[model samples]
Target: MADAAPPLQRLKGAMDAILVADVFLVMAGAAWFGVAVLCHSQKIEAPLQLFQTLWEPLFTPAIGLLMAAALLSGLLGWWQRRGQKRAPGTGS
Candidate 1:
């Protein structure tokens, strides 16, 4: 097993990349919304229109993906820890 990559290393790497992308999308969407709010308050209509146009298609999915990722990560970590607690050779 020395030469082989650790099991799920590639999966973990992919998940890491996806999670990073998801985080960035969520943050970018949030910043865009903030900018839109500022623009709307200042009567700058262009960005407000852009934000509204992108809201349903892009930002919504990004937000959902972030929420799902967070929940899944938490649940998986909890399950992993629970399994470890029952692992062989650990205290009864």
Candidate 2:
């Protein structure tokens, strides 16, 4: 039917979802690490070990991917806006 979105729109929507998920994971991991640091500074052990457990498997890759995703999203948005700004008669 005519209700379906274009393929590009669908792809962009999926990319946005991935970007949000990456951002959430990175933020949650960083927050957990912060809490672990505070616990260590106070000579307590609330989530020090748990945070370490997540550092390698979850946090590390998520942090790296989040940076890449953010860069891609920024560039994609910029490219889209710039293209939209261009007109048939404009040349600059």
Candidate 3:
């Protein structure tokens, strides 16, 4: 028993894991936003048609949709886990 983590310690560890998940989700969202901006500003079009020719290809929308899904799912999962941790009987 001496080497075992106390109940409180275990609970804290679980909480930390939840926090890490939240952090990772936020970082991924930022990265996705950055990539979208990069694609929008590239020199793929002729001169003087920078903003006019955006989204000509399908990859732009596909990337945006995937990123949106990831963000939405990540937020939902984080909230669900947080609620579970705070529920009754989940004690140290």
> What TM value does model 2 have?
0.70
Global lDDT of each candidate: 0.88, 0.85, 0.62
User: Can you give the TM-score per candidate against the true fold?
Assistant: 0.82, 0.70, 0.38
- Which pairs clash in the backbone of model 1? none
Candidate 3 local lDDT, 13-78, one digit each (tens) = 986676566556556655655665676588433422433354345335545555776788799899
Please report how far candidate 1 places residue 42 from its true position, in Å: 1.3
Best by TM-score: 1
Candidate 1 vs 3: which has more TM-score: 1
Worst 10-residue lDDT window for candidate 3 reads 43-52
Model 2, 27-62: lDDT tens digits are 888888898899999998869988888789988888
Please report how far candidate 2 places residue 15 from its true position, in Å. 1.5
What is the TM-score of candidate 1? 0.82
Q: Candidate 3: deviation at residue 69, Å?
A: 24
In lDDT terms, which candidate is top? 1
